[model samples]
Target: MADSFLRPAVSTMRSGIAGALIAVLALAAAPTIASAQTAAPATKPAAKPAPATKPAPAEPAKDAAAPEDPLPWIKICSKDADKKNVCLVAKELRSQEGQLVASVALRDIEGDSKKVLLIAVPPVVLIQPGMRVQIDKGKQLEAKYTICFPNACYAEMEIADQAIAEMKKGKALVVTSLNIQQKPMAFPFLLSTFKKAAEGEGIDPNAGQQNQEQLQQELQKRAEEAAKKLQGGDAAKPADAPATPAPAPAPAEAPKP
Candidate 1:
């Protein structure tokens, strides 16, 4: 009887253990089945935006420069005999007939920090009108007539920093003055001369001494030639022509009668 009871209890315990194992297995398989049934959340790719393009830059403004002179022009720097800079620029203008009409010169004198501009126009221009200068049709500058010589009328003005800057940037300079008929006449000035003048040039220290020496030598030579001519003329004056027939020596013979 006891064996039968023990066998029944053992069978019941095995049944209970098998049911608990099945429940545990179902619980573990539930998550795997649910995961299999549901698909991974579809992740839509983000839409890409177009690149922002930059606008093109605007063109720069052009410089409003004037036309160049058609006539012959020169860019010259004046130097002493010793090859030292005496002046920055000396621009000479000639007429179509090859006659000099005007000259413009720039010089930086020693001990003076200011630069001087000297313009020489024909004597026909009126002294009162002086010179009306315009740089590239910009500002109008009036310079007074300082003096006049036989060949030209001179207008002098000190070149300040502002004038130099304007000249360098300018293409052409127009100078106007009154003619003999009191009519306005225009002269085109090449800016290249101003550029050459503005360049920092070295001045000659011995230029004054050299000029004085040259002048003295020239004067001495002229004096010697004059003296020689005078002496020669005095010597030849009696011989070139017969002397007044010796005041008629026959008159002396007649005194005796």
Candidate 2:
């Protein structure tokens, strides 16, 4: 038996023991790390549920109004503009294109003017002279006015077939503006220019004149009839009907005794 072989064998056995210890420690540490990672997610609470939403209620309906009544078409019945008062405001009888209309009395016109300018306000319309306005018909337009620069005396107007026919030639439209000549001599000249322009547009001159005359005659006839009735000529009631009763006056209070 040799001592040398025994020493070598002892050293080899010590090395093997040390390697086994290291492997055991590694297996134990691995289990602890895996357990910690797995348990972390389980401890966390579940996310809170979202809140529920509700829809809004529907709105109620609203009320609407009816359509409006159109303005009455009319022209001057009298061309008596020379004395203190020339035009008499009256209700419109009818329109040139077609239709019957009503009107309201505003004030008596002053001066001696032929043509009257009628301002249409919904149901009521007025005709007055010395007034300037713009008219359009399907494709026609007529603008009557005056110009005074330094010494210009003559006033002129125009009626074109293609530009503003929608206003002057059309069956219906609006009167946007109203201007009176204010000067008597200028108005008749203005009227002549307007008449010529209308003739050029194929508008029935006789018809327009007839309308004016008809209105005049109607108004005059009405006046005469009114006068006759007032004078006991033709009346529904006796001319000797009792007069209207007067209103009673307020009584004064007596002083306390």
In order, the Cα lDDT scores of the candidates are: 0.53, 0.29
Q: Give the Å error, residue 156, model 1.
A: 0.7
Q: Model 1: how far is 19 from its true place, Å?
A: 99
Identify the runs in model 1 with alpha carbons over 4 angstroms from their true place. Answer: 1-86, 200-257
lDDT of 2 by residue, 98-193 (tens): 122212111224532233322322111112322233332233223332322221111223423332233334322222222232322101001112
Please write out the lDDT profile of model 1 over residues 1-257, one tens digit for every residue: 00110011211112232233233223222112112233357446568846547646645544434333322122234455665544444444433222234556556554457887777665667787678877776878887888765545778777776876888776666667887788876656667546644564533435523432354365456557877899988877555775565554453444544
Runs off by more than 4 Å, candidate 2: 1-132, 136-154, 168-215, 230-257
Top candidate (lDDT): 1
Q: Please give the distance, in angstroms, between residue 29's alpha carbon in candidate 1 and its true position after superposition.
A: 99
